[model samples]
Target: MNNAQEARRILRAHRYGALSTLSKKFDGYPFGSITPYLTDHDGSLLILISTLAEHTKNIQNDPRVSLITHDQRDPHIQTQGRVTVVGDAQPEPEREKAGQRYLRYFPEAQTYFAMHDFSFYRIRPVAIRYIGGFGRIHWVNMNNYAVADAEAFVQQEDALLAEVNARSSNALCRLLQQRHGISAMEAHAVGIDCDGLDVYHAEQTWRLDFPETAGIESITESLAQLLTATP
Candidate 1:
């Protein structure tokens, strides 16, 4: 895969990151906080935060922010792949839409979603730093990094997930075992994007990268090939 796609895959595999925002109370100093974020279909991040939160207050004072997430499963922190997104965070106007997608990944956040103080913020990336390994690194080109023709995929995501969960559970189970060596009695497709699919099994989520980029028209065939190719 290209550096950009690899960077996106890393971001999609993990959920939370260290968010750095300009502190409102501390005179524009950098303030860091751990926050859960969803990698949206277009590669932007969606985060739910309370208005009363320190990060939120900082964002209000200045929208400029950055978040870094790395592979948590890797034991060697220095060598593991990571992606840092330098971006601007703004309130997402489409609350219900964002909530639907965000809640699927973070069901426990339902209570927070219902609260009046909580709101969704979209972090649009200005630049991305991707470190593939100790020596593999690159400043991902924005044009190549961004997903093209993503609207169709986003609109069809729910239906696609429903079909996979309802009809392809066994295949998904085998896939988890084949790709991740984790045998699962049941597996559910919680999310799908251009890069790959996210499977929830055994109380944890596993990422399965597609052989190639998949669009709405090719996703079915892409999945079929992926499932059938594995054992």
Candidate 2:
């Protein structure tokens, strides 16, 4: 695998992350929140926040933000590594598409969705601070990281997702409905990295990034075909 693939592997391993933003309520102090963010095809963050959410309000006041998601394991806790994303927050144009992608990974978000006060936010990463282990860390500049339009993920959502979600076919869909308690209406692709693909369903985002047998070119081609067929 390449550097991008390696970096993506570590990222897909963890989900929950702490997001820090400038506070709008308390004299602009630093405000931190435990948020669920989905990574898009090119590695940028996609989040859905309620308009009434403190972080959403804070972001409206100041778009700068950071998120830290780390590996959860024994010794790794001390320095297993956490990827920090520093970027700008802005409402995404593709709210419906993003919401579909996000809710799959976080099924519990159904409650949030029902409220109808939330809106989608997309992060455009300027730089990524990656820590491999204790004392082993480096900053990734834009050139080293992939920064594509937010639409890329949305545009490829349908077709590629079918392949990934269809792998286990009926069983996986049934499992999501029975065990996960998700209606599982449809599956959308929220993430695609050099390592694998992420297909969102309900509360559990299924990660398909098995580096040992991931085919980036084939997937890319499939997505390309789907887009052309979009009329």
Error of 1 at 155 (Å): 1.0
lDDT of each: 0.91, 0.67
Model number with the top TM-score: 1
lDDT tens readout by residue for model 1, 1-231:
799989989999999999999999999999999999999999999999999999999999999999999977778999899999999999999999999989888888999999999999999999999999988989999998898857887889998899888888998889888988997888899998888899987667789889888877898998878777746
RMSD of each: 1.1, 7.1
Model 2, range 1-231, lDDT digits (tens) per residue? 444445555666567789999998897788999988777766778887899889999999999999888854446586576788899999898767677767767777878876768888888887778777778777865565663433544565566666654553444454445444656666655555445555566445655444242344455654343333311
Q: State candidate 1's TM-score.
A: 0.97
- What candidate 2 gets wrong by more than 4 Å, as runs, is 1-5, 73-75, 147-154, 167-193, 199-203, 212-216, 220-231
RMSD of 2: 7.1
